[model samples]
Target: MFSEWKFTAKEIAEKPDLFLSGHRACAGCAPATVLRLIMKAVRGPTIVTNATGCMEVVSSIYPYTSWAVPWIHTAFENAAANASGIESALKILKKKGKIKHEHVDVIALAGDGGTYDIGIQALSGAVERGHDFLYVLYDNEAYMNTGIQRSGGTPFGASTTTSPAGTVIPGKLQNKKPIADIMVAHEIPYVATASPFYWRDLITKARKGIEVDGPAFLHVFAPCPRGWRSDPAKSIELSRLAVETCIFPLWEAINGEYQLSTPSKVLALAPQKKKPVREYLKLQGRFRHLFTPKFEKLTEEIQRITDERWQRLLRKCGMT
Candidate 1:
């Protein structure tokens, strides 16, 4: 469904920059990478609504600002609703000939806590209303802004403040909430999953979202180093692993027709190319307890789950 969009990295560079340097995001933050790419693809007027999280705090501190365009930072759970309101007003303003912009795309940017849990209802309302806007969920997999607590988007067996590794329950009890699939179920004009690991693909998706006539949702897999307790420099590397391991498959659905964008080619011959989940787990302090034998079983189960999902997706895509 998204194959119609076309863009090259060189062309993206020629576009005007919306996100400049000297921002306050953590070192090697995936969200910042995605923001730059999104900004590069944007043309004409644009308004951004940011939920209270790392992106808000880091970009719009008390006395400083990092955004070059119009931005509003609302509470942690109402960014989508706020953006919808802005879009509605803009539609009226445009119809009245009060606004003179040929292209003005409104987008809501939120972290996992805001998107997957607290703000899900508001987001659903906005999309279901068929708002002419885009909602970008930057899935760092936890509430990274406020001490890295476990959010609904946290992956299974991953450790977090609320779901820490304990004697009874090892890490998060449930897997991720699969917010992308939920957005797809809304039957929007465009729904895609992308990562900062592939900046070109991310920019392409953003451009497509802007051109789409109706609601568009883009789920971004952003790796959190401080929260995940991993090396700050391995943000993109970890994100790539997430896709390769099937923990975060890149796919999309347009008007409820599902299509796999990046197939589970990495899982085609699992035995030969499988990277030990231990390597990925060991990088984070949350899964520290899983080094033991009993808790190691959880890791085994997670791998099996990921493998199974990849196999299932392959069949769905008719790649089997």
Candidate 2:
């Protein structure tokens, strides 16, 4: 029996070429990046349950599968439920001495729509039950697989097919929901927000999630170029912009205590000069209508909200 178990930072960084190249993720899908990074940290037998979304259709298109590890594509709202079943079965099998190892890591992967909106009930149930597994949410901020539709995780004032920015309502009106905070409220051992731009921080959180004995939820803000109306080449750059601009703050919750993953020094150096929200908004086809003076007013409103949120995070991190 193994006395202790944990993955080192270096070991986690040395991920093998498991997720083969030539997969069908969008030109710059963050989920693909997350899958590769997570595989590096996980050892022994592992199983993945993916929700019906972009990652499902792109990576596993029938006979042409790109996953080098074991994966299953479940319903759009049942990835967490399916993973729970798998974990229970593995536990029974191991107890009966039918399995070689004492532990089999199981993970459920889902897009923002599945995690924050549709699949939330199942996710809440699984975590509340104290299951031993991890749920990685690749939040592209919308229903990218179906089309550029608004999801609950999508930030306010972001245009989408469902939340169009017209003369009436200026895009998605509601602010982005704090799903990580909800998970932390469940009292899980680990809950974190990671970004593809921050690979080191991403790997660190994933490694910790796996070692956590109970349910762990990781909300990863992955940039979707096609959906977000941005250049595919600027995917990573946008990821960095999201954090530096305080649009997406990186942090973690360990047993209900929160810690800002980005250092104070890094926070201090954040761009005092932020690009106009229009610069970020106008690139996407969804927000094409938001170019007029009225739209400019909406842009200012968004900026104000972003500033307030950033200041709040600064206070939360004890930097204020």
Candidate 3:
């Protein structure tokens, strides 16, 4: 199906802006770019339900909004629930001949804090109910909108306000929650991981997710300049490095079957081609402490964890 999807630069340039400018996302904000790319993939009428997080706070300030489509700002724990209700209401309206459209896509957007933590229950319930909707989690890894607090999605050794690196502790003690794996466990029609750096892959996944008949989930990595203390200009670079290092392998699942995306597939087939995870860590200030002599082992531990995860993913894809 993805092979059938095609778009050219000119065609993309001609598409109307579904996510407009003039709101207040930070400069070089990858989540904002993620929203734009997702909107670019939309083919028909759509409604968006967004959880309260960085994107919501920045995109919908006061009387203004960046969304050109019908959008609702839901509480932190209810975006997916809201989307499920919207999909059901649309179905009812169509049955009653109150709505003319044959189909209207429902999309739910949330950050890591809202999705991996507060909103997991709602997301799980909606998917289990076989809701016809797409849930996109733009993961910046921390509660960026709430002052960079540590969250379930936060990686180990990443210092945050709550998980500060110090003498006794070296950051979050837990591994990043395997949210994508959890979504795949739901046995949804579609589940994918994406990054803004891979525009084509991201767009294709978004379109596929929206077109699926049942619940779909896309866990998108969105680099945060503020939260990660990385250079604004390096957002895309960080995104690329993340995949190259196997820190965030691009992959998808359909009907509980896993397949690595093209870029990650290459690395999986030739393990030596994968870059060391340190290249990704060195670019971000959150991992600065890991490079110190006192915490040197933490860096090695992070690399080992990344390698283990990548190998496990390869096994799932039947590449190992």
Candidate No. with top TM-score: 3
Model 2 off-target regions past 4 Å?
Answer: 1-14, 263-265, 268-285
Supply the TM-score for candidate 2.
0.90
- Candidate 1 residues 20-100, lDDT tens each? 777899997888888888887675689998999998888887677888899998698998899888999999998999989
User: What is candidate 2's lDDT per residue for 254-304, written digit by digit as tens?
Assistant: 888777886323764555554545556665666666667676677778778
Segments in model 3 whose C-alpha atoms lie over 4 Å from true places = 1-3
* Candidate 3 lDDT over residue span 1-320, tens digit each: 33467998688768998999997999889999999999999989999999999899888997899999999985999999999899999999999999999999999999999999999999999999999988999999999998999999999999999999998799999999999999999888899999989988999999999988999999999999999999999999999999999999999998889999998998887878999989999999998898888898998899999989988998899987
- lDDT against the true structure, each candidate: 0.82, 0.81, 0.93
Full ranking by TM-score: 3, 1, 2
Residue 110 error, candidate 3, Å: 0.3
True-vs-predicted CA distance for residue 251, candidate 2, Å? 0.4
> Per-residue lDDT for 200 in model 2?
75
Predicted structure 1, TM vs. truth: 0.93
